[model samples]
Target: MSTAVATATPTARPTSRRRRRIGSTEIVYLALVGILVVAGVLVAMGGGNLFSTANTAYMLTQTSLLGFVAIGQTFVILCRSLDLSVGYVVALCSIVGATTMAGDPSRVWLGVVAALAAAAGIGLVNGLVVTKLRVNAFIATLGVGLIVKGYLDTQFKGPAGDVPSSFQMFGYTRVGPVPISTIVMLVVAAVGIVLLTRTRQGYHMFAVGGNVDVARLSGIRADRTVIIAHVLCSTCAGIAGLLIAARFGTGNALVYSYGLDLDSIAAVVLGGTLLLGGRGSVAGTVGGVLILAVLDTVFNVLDVDPFFKDVLRGVVIIAAVALYARRQIDPASSRARFRSNRRRDPVRSGARPDPTTTDGGASA
Candidate 1:
């Protein structure tokens, strides 16, 4: 018998390149930041006084309030759900805070606490309806918003009067030349980022949004994750309402009459989170808010009519979504090319087939 030994096959080096050429999140962030910078430059060139301290402060303050709402919207959107009740929640909380505090500086803290509690309660109810009752998030939140709006209207019977002086400080006060509202917004964004990136709960949220059935089978409590997301979102909205009321020194019950949901959704989408869910970042959200604020300020400085602003916003949002969609599709082609290359590699021949491996061969 001739002793024949099979020649040892050299193992192919695993490609160090990441499977994903460009992460959607990274691309979205870069694109948003680029847009913001360009818009800022255009506004400056258009005599918008982009470098003025007052103008910068104004932009920060304006973005701060909307930013808070967008942050809340981020959570809901991440969970693959919608929260239509944010505007109503803001209106209700603002009314409650204004009427109860009503120029009583000392009672500002009480009003703040009450508003937050009310907001959280509303969020809990929304979560219960969606998770327990199996109601769709859109319809359920819409109905809840209407009910809250009606309830607030009944209580106010009209627009709210002046807010407390202490409460006003939240929106108007500054720290080392920075608006308090802006600081608060930054803090909220920071907290949200930490929660989503560092916690196990955050992983569960992604899993839940990515695939509810698979997450459930994998021992994650999808329902709880969604419910938590809703609660957190509403709480953020409530804080935003307080800030808005403080800024104007009054709560008109119609403060949220413009339907903030649409703007919030637009900001979230612009930030790179898919409407279908499971992917995004708080940093991207901040960029999106800045972009919107810049655009709004530019339009105002240009003396564009408010109605025209809506048209502009619609166009920008559509464009952003289209770009994002294109980016999402780009990866598929790269993946296919990678698969083809692997299939043509001779090293794969005569190996025990392993479908789970990217190269379709057993690991050496």
Candidate 2:
């Protein structure tokens, strides 16, 4: 019994450690924290304050637009799909909102509704193409995006409709170090978190993404769930368009040139969501967005070229995805090995075989 107790001590410690192992989300945030520390030091060395009141507001403000799009991206990605059409949808929605508002404050809500409705409609089409017509999500969204872009190119040459000052408040208003846009973005993210963790639709999304055949066998409506996710994603992108219109005080036909579609996807991946799908969270996505915003802020402070910013972002995304993939693969392999070792050799796994059970001569 004493020998067994000693052996058990080693096994128990590993079990406890495994239970308390840091998850992908925690790792992401930890990386964010480390990045912030490094950024602060670098900025300070360059004769700037990273956490100044103005800079803090700027960072959060930067996060607002991307956060909205990334939050939306989180949903569809978790459902094993992507939306390349988001950039075009954003451009279309901005035009729709501004044109509908036509500079009337009373029309603000009207514009908002119009933009969201347009986005949801586009999302519906994308989903239908992918789920019903059996088009791959990537191709479906890209085709839709090209169609929307062609429409925009044929109709508009530059910024068109106007945004009212009242609506502009969303882009500029700040309370302390937090912008109202950031606050709104956070609220949307909270709703996403709830949808994922507390709602049936959310569970179905995970189940379907994890394995469509299994979900189907379990009586889940996989197509409906994917459609729902796409709708939610485009709606979020529409909200982001609204933010852009608010910030610029007009609808810019060329907003799609910002590469928001890829940026949002990168943010979603950086937040620890699997690229192929099935496991992730809104909170992690939010953290990922903040890291991008921080990098943006730091770049601006250092006067880096816009092209270089994109390059750096691409590198970061690649690195983050690689790291996250390793993290995902390693733990499962570790658990499998641990189980196999325990089954094959109990003593090696820190278990002492019972003498009475294994050998009658030893029992005597």
- Using lDDT as the measure, which candidate wins? 2
Report the Cα RMSD per candidate. Answer: 5.6, 4.7
The total of clashing pairs for model 1 equals 0
Cα lDDT of model 2 by residue, 195-286, tens digit: 99999999998998899889999999999999999999999999999998998888888989988999899899999998678899999999
User: Per-model C-alpha lDDT, please?
Assistant: 0.82, 0.91
CA deviation > 4 Å runs, candidate 2 = 1-19, 331-364
Best-performing candidate as measured by TM-score: 2
Model 1: weakest 10-residue lDDT segment is 354-363
TM-scores of all candidate predictions against the true structure: 0.85, 0.90
165-222, model 1: which lDDT tens digit per residue?
7678898898755798999899999999998899998888778878889999999988
lDDT of 1 at 142: 96
